[model samples]
Target: MGVTLKDVAAAAGVSRSTASRALSGSALIAAETRALVEDAARRLGYRPNRAASALRSRQSHLIGLVVGNLVNASFHTIAEVVQRRAAAEDYQMMLSITDADPRREEGILRTLGEHGVDGVILIGTGSNAAASNALLSGGTAVVNLIRGAAESAAPTVLASDRDGAGDATRHLLELGHRRIGYIGGPPGTNSGDERFAGYEQAWRDHGLPLDERLIERGPFEPSFGSDATGRLLARVPEMTALFAANHEAVFGVLPALVAAGVRVPDDLSLVCYEDISWLRWWQPPVTVVDNGARELGELAMDLLLQQLERGRGSVPQARNGRTYRVGAQLVQRESSARPRDV
Candidate 1:
């Protein structure tokens, strides 16, 4: 049987009331008495029941972490950080996955509220604002990760897509590649739109005409990337380079290139976002835009704790909303080279 408070009290020769105070750090006990209780707890290997403690305090100290699309390695990296951060602060996590759908996010939030999570940390784009509003209405603190545009005034932490995309575009432009193609993420996702806008802005800044025929949008699936790549190649046969929005999208594009017998870097060079573990280990090392995902998660949890302590009283600066933008950097690799003719 597990050691209990009664065992600890008995071993310490102290009253139950005194033992509880010593263990919970609630009331201040004498130094001698506290020492005795600590010694007894250590000797007896006493473990306090967290559920019981939560019930007595009416505070779970548990954050509901609802993530969308765990298939994306970056999200998993963020989750690892969140779990560690929550534990460091003497809190727990109630995790959920919504798989990139707004309706599912609504259901997950409702379930988390019913189960009594202290706060919620959402990691995705385009969740139900009504559902999040409902969570706040019930006095639950919320934070968003990897989401730039949101309806709620709640704090959000997003990857810096605009500048990262522009950097990628500039790299290609400097390589003397005039015909560049882009494959973007889902339409409603803020990151997708911002990245697409950045791509366009880079072209304009370089005095290069925007080619509507070279752009395509789809789900961030490998198959969609392959299809988009094939379509872009057909429409703009002279295009010498491609910029895909993500690693998964690149997965699709690479296979399509292989099937068509298109030589990489020689026929077409590629720059993509995200470098998964296996990616760098593969044949041609892929050049990519790597945002600090673990840092993003840690910052989001920090913001959630801050918002919870603040209790919606103060308005955050910048667009009159609570939001955070995590910066990203481009990783150059062997997959991209100077244009064939150059």
Candidate 2:
């Protein structure tokens, strides 16, 4: 017969309940007893059935983490931090990638729900309110990361996109770049809107006329970045600096600049939003406004832990949806400089 708790208890010379408590690391059991029970179980090759224990305790000890995609460096940091934090707390993390598609997000949420995850941390697509709320209404703790869904009541953790973009714009402005071009993300996204607003605010702060012709808004794809760069260069040939607010777009921006025979800082200075490792190694390096991805991930885990503590299967009371913002900082590098003419 397979080794069981009863066999372990006999070997440890204790009652079955004592063996169970000791193996489960219950603090109520004495240190010495726990050691004895652990030793006995190891010697007898007895393993506790986690599924049976979860059934008894009503906690799956699992957390679900959903992200738009792993391509963004910020998402990569968030996944690493959340996974480590969940492990430290004895919770298994289940990760899902949704490509920012609402339908995919809905399906992932439903699957996580079926798995009975105790809580979820996700970069919401801002269009999956129904799926998210259904989980929350059923007592599953949910914490939104990065983008947020307005209709969902879940707490959110985000980087200060407005402040970060403003910093990038101001940096270019300070460097004597009068005609600065901006490449940014799509309109409806929270980060995209806030970043664009910050750019406009910076121009207003500097008393400069906001030139609408120098701005391009599109997807985070390299093709969009290349196309936007072409349009800006063609439309505003005198543009002295470019703030590539979309990180993914920077990839396309650099290649397009090269193809156009534009030299960094000499002909055109550049500043990008969000820091990734490769930015520091690029020829001449790249200046960036760093949105604190690591800090955002850590804070998201903290918020989810708070929700988990409120008890499983209990809905949170109605209150103003709370958002926690991580600070952003500008990391200066070789890519930005005073315009040659200035």
Candidate 3:
């Protein structure tokens, strides 16, 4: 038979009430007594019953993490960070991947809600407004990460996409590149819009001519990256440098640059918005922004826990909405330099 609370109290020489309070993590229990009871419980192989605890406390202590795309490194990092943070507070985490599909996201959110998740953190999911909307109204507190241009009532946390991209653009300008090109995510997507806005802001700040011919925006695919680089090079031969929208595109852009006889920092400088592994040790370590995905995850969890602890009404909402902003840092590296002519 499994050891019960009675066995634990008997082993610890404490009353059943004291043992129950200690096992339930009641603050009223003295630390020494709590430790003694916990130690005795361990020695006696006594496991607390989760169902009984949940029934009494009305807390399942489970947080659901929803990622739009599992293949993306940033999302994976966020999930890892969130899981760690949740565990620190004695809460368990469950992860669900949506593959950027709004329908899938909606279904997963409903399932998690039905399964008694205390809260949820949603990573970017393209333009899935309905999913977010349902989550907000469905009585579950939710948080968003890396999402821009979305009308969300949830308390959101994300890296500053505009400022990060602006920093990258300004870096190229400082390197004396007059004719810069840009390869980016699909237009209208939240991330794509904000990042591209940053690219535009840099040019307006410097009074540099915004050349449409030197720009290409498309899906964040390696094939698009490789093909876009070729097309941009062909159409705008004088372009001295390029900024890729994300890490996945860089995977394709780098190889295309090599095939086109483009020497990094010498023939054509290149940078990407999202930092990834291959960008770390390439012949030219690509200069890029660290989007602080992990930090955002940690903060997102904190926000969710706040909702869980204080209740949804205490989180507050506003005309502009509530958000927590995490900053992104630009890691300058060998891939970027002054244009050959400059």
Candidate 4:
């Protein structure tokens, strides 16, 4: 049999991670351990044909990357990062979108399996945990970006959804607006729930009562935001400020408000969850929670590389699950202000 990573590990009396780091030329490995691993490889007549090793291990060096709700510009940021990272690691990424549908996620994953992807990176708003668990059980190396899968399955790169939401809500509350409306993303998404939780927590902390009628669920799409804005306006016509869950939703809400002759900030203030590029150049601009999209994407790629190295030659325990969280920042722009009646 050809020499394997385990063979080198055994010969060098070092862990597989040590062996991988040594071979991959990472700076983190100890000099002595690196020398030992190299000596063992030479002694064992081990020539690492990366292509062959990948094939023998049933890893195609192709990772199936699934994204949901691409309408959110955040996904576009993530796609760029993932592709760049994949290229750096000499791997190929296959991209697909599910539009946040569970059935579609399943279908796409099944196709990925047929096409021989060794791993997957699922990026979305964290709903299909059950389906993600199924993928884990099938021996596909899976990582989650801005979403969470089963706790026992893969590592997650999560953005600070709660912090961002709380900041948005607190901004409005501090502006002396008591009658604030919240337009959130779909019920199935963890980002939506976590953000709404932050909204509630902010209100409770400030001794403000949360009116159920003031909260509305809209999918992560501009059209849904428009529809939800209309419904909330009809229910509570006197609402002075709105906290929208995402940039796309903000786009929807802003146009509707303008069409209704509602002066932004002067009449109805808006705080949204993300910083899309066009927001800076918009007529009135936008005050939003920056969700650290680029950082989240970069760190996610790092975590995926870690998994690939750690889980290369042996089974990993469930306790090895990892998470890297990036915090949120609130960017002040022109769209939010003190209430008109204040």
Task: Tell me the deviation in Å of residue 137 in model 1.
Answer: 3.0
Off by over 4 Å in 2: 1-7, 10-13, 40-47, 259-261, 312-318
lDDT of each: 0.80, 0.89, 0.81, 0.81
Off by over 4 Å in 4: 1-57, 124-139, 150-152, 311-320
At residue 80, give the lDDT of candidate 4: 88
Best by lDDT: 2
Candidate 1 similarity to native, TM-score = 0.87
* Candidate 4 clashes between residue pairs 3 or more apart in a chain or in different chains: none
TM-score of every prediction relative to native: 0.87, 0.92, 0.86, 0.79
Give the per-residue lDDT of model 4 (tens digit) for 1-342: 888888998999999878988987779998888999999999998777767656766677887779886677888998888889898887888889998777888788778766667678888546555555565666667778876755435778888898899999999999999989898876656687789889999999998788999998767778878888888888998999999885568768878887778778887888888788887877688888999999988887777777677653323454645777899999999989998788
Clashing pairs in 2: none
Model 4's lDDT to the true fold? 0.81
On residues 1-342, what C-alpha lDDT tens digit does candidate 1 reach at each position? 899999999999999889989876655898788889999999998988878977887667889888776667787888788888888877788778877777888889889888767888887556576677677767778887786436665677888888889989998899888888999887778778878888999999998899889898888678889899889888999989999975557778878888888777788888887657766765577778887788788898888888667653333334424677888898888778889888
Residue 130's lDDT within candidate 1 is: 62
Clashes of each: 0, 0, 0, 0
Q: Where is model 1 more than 4 Å wrong at Cα? A: 1-4, 25-47, 311-320
